[model samples]
Target: MSKRTAIIDIGSNSARLVIFEKTSRYGFHLICEQKSKVRIGEAAYEKEGYLQPIGIKRAYFTLKSFLHTIDKYQANKTLCIATSALRDAPNGKEFVQWIQKELGLSIKVIDGNKEAKYGGIAAVNLLPISEGISIDIGGGSSDMTLIKHGYIVDTYSLDLGTVRLKELFFDKGVNPSEINEKAKAYIQHELEKLPEHFRHTLAIGIGGTARTLSKGIMKQVAYPLDKLHAFTYNVSEHRSYLDAIPLSSAKNLKRFGLKKNRYDTIREGTLIFNEILSHIGTETVISSAAGVREGVYLEQLLKKDNLKFPSRINPSVTSILDRFQPLVNIQKNQKTKRKLASNLYTVLQQDINDNKQYEKELLWAVKLSSIGQTLTVYRSHQHAFYIAMQELNHGFTHEEILLISFLLRMNEKELLNKPLFTHYKPLLPEKSTLLWLSFIYTLTVLLQEASNNAGITFTYTNKTLRIISDKPLYLAKEKVKALEKPIPFAIIIEDESTLPKNKKLGI
Candidate 1:
């Protein structure tokens, strides 16, 4: 049976509730999410570091409504965590006690180090990054975690955040130049206290500030894809826009297509972010939509299994399969197709100049090729392409997703060309390489469906390729010939029984 869980993250800037439905052990999807800009840290920075009455009231109402959602979904578990705002406040613990007494809810207040650790965990487990520094800029504090070899190596939390900085300098109506100099000086001083070893070339940005910045950049560049999780940019390439943000007025910011509510703190957030990038000597920044909420859910799930992290499980693939598996019964066939496709790819590697970089994507295409059969057998390949493009949300770069979808959309004798190819040309591999992968996938599926056997083998030369199977090859041979028109080489299919018993086909 499936399970559902809810995680409530009450940060300095906003209170959010995310409900996740677990269709399988490690396969889950976001069912519903709610965010309220309660600004729980509003005026707390200037008000002697106490949880302000208005802020507390806003948080209370947000949580009360979130509880109604938990009851609606019947979430099996609920985790409420408070970050810098609550943890740094003088009356933070007092507020937690009151919430427990009045709202019947228990909130776990985590320190800075723990918050950094959770953010790091979310990045390493979800994003395709192994070595980088994750910067999560919250409303009250910024957390930095140094990750090496897929583990958190060091963590540092600075009292530099959007709300905090805005309260200290920007709200005073200081000129842009003075505000910039003062903020930079303070940021540099705090960052200098950390060890020099924390510097890295890649920086992963989390939290609202990072997400909003990525969206603004995407709009400026007219990026084709609307996805935000893996949106990336070169710091040097976009430095001009980053430099202009602090000086831009609210109207100017809105002209840049920023949300109205985000205008107040975006300037402060951008200044802090640009300073961090400069200090760390980072060249690239990848935006991550997952943060404290995802990290908290993962921590709880892993604890139940007594494991720290999943052992080589792709969360995106698992989640997709969990949702569509009941509609399709092709697991065994999918495995057979993948094996056969891999063997064929190996045999043709020499002729195709294979770099083996796309091997994983080819296998993914094989496993998901038949998913479209659930909807209808007519134009199933097109259906599969649509499903993959729209539904495969995590654990893949934009390029990989497009490549996989394009391969699934291939029909016999179709080669990638202009207009259609131009849309994703920047992210795609060479045309010849894509064609070879598409052919391999098509041939494998056709042969596997035609024959019932434990294994199939292949042999290839510059001019021709041969398929050797233990079973009769009459039907398989016909399909192979029909689909061989796009390939440069001819194909021959033969029964393995015709050969000597001592001979073995290359796999």
Candidate 2:
């Protein structure tokens, strides 16, 4: 029997539950994740910075749902933590007592510093190659942590986050100058406590505020899937963009391409964001998809000395192949197609390996491009493409998942007139992204050859890729036309006796 553990994070703005199921291998898989945007901080700010009964009621409901989930999963252990809004409330202790007595759920109200610590642990899980300051901008507060050599160096939690900032600054209808004066002073005072060693470090950000900023950049450049995960934006670039927006209405903000729900709060969010960046002399903001709840999971993981803290997501494509094996009869063909893509991946690792994630997602899409046949036999390529792009989930963030799905949905023709993923282009280096996607697509169609029975083997060198195959009458000539697009290297096809002139293919 396996043990399942659950963690509930009841924050000021949103409440979340993350469950981990430990299998026989002793590694835990993310079993379920859910959140409720209860806006607890809104009420806390309204009732003179205290949580109102209405807000508590809504939060209790959310916590009850989490309880049901834990019961359903048969979880043996559960941990619950509440931050900023609850800690600040006069009746917060009573609230915790109320939950324990009424719902039979134990809870802990974590201080700002501890919140910073757990958020740091979670950020450590996400950024394996980075040593930096981790930030989680919650609805009520922003938790900051400095990590070096896998140990927490410094930590803080400021009363500045999306919900709290919006309530205290923007939502009050205060003029921009007055708001900036108050928030800037608060932030500057908070920064005085940060150790000097953390200054100018890479800023790793977690939560909605960070993701909202990332999505805007994604939509701006049409940044494809690969760039979305570890995408970096410096303070200057982000500040200028935020400065231009009025942040009054979603429509006014839509021109910036942020989600409608984000615009009302993002102005204050960005202000606090820029303030922290300037205070710490941060070089860049690395958006981390995991946050508090993941930290709760990591805490349990760390206790066993088998810490996967510094978590790295396998390329979406590789993760899918490893987890969801292709259907029965087609499994063999899928394996061949994957091996073929891997061969190309090995050949081009030099010019293309800046991001293994983008490559893995592409090749993974290619491998399963044939999996949609369970629905019907006809037009499986379209089905497969749709499924690969739209349906698959590899714990991808909202933006990256969207980019991957969009890339899969696009076609060669779609590539010609302003590509669908073009919105994210400005945020990323184009040559690497376009090259990765295009090569993966080309290799996919080549290997599938429209699912023919022909035997083919390809040998790859730094400059060229060689294919040996006997032409089968079953495939369409247009299948070869897919490779006619402009590519840098050459592809040559050799016959059994090596008789036909070596074909030189151009990108």
TM-score of each: 0.92, 0.68
Question: How much is 177 displaced in model 1, in angstroms?
Answer: 2.0
Tell me the tens digit of each residue's lDDT in model 1 across 1-507. 238889999999899999988877787789999999988989999888898989999999999999999999999888899999999899999999999998888999998888888898888877878889999999988899999988888999888889889988888864788888888888888888767887998999999888888998999988877778878899999899888998876567876667777998999999889988999999999889898888888777666644245665777778777765435346687778888888888988887777677989999988877777777888888888888888776667888888888887876545453565777777788877887888888887778767875457888876788888777666767667777344578888767656567766643
- Backbone clash total for model 1 is 0
| Model 2 TM-score, 2 decimals | 0.68
Tell me the RMSD of model 2 versus the true structure.
Answer: 6.8
Model 2 lDDT per residue over 10-88, tens place: 8877888988776433245577888888777675676677777678889989988889999998888999989888888
219: Cα error in model 1, Å:
2.2
Residue-level lDDT for 366 in candidate 2: 62
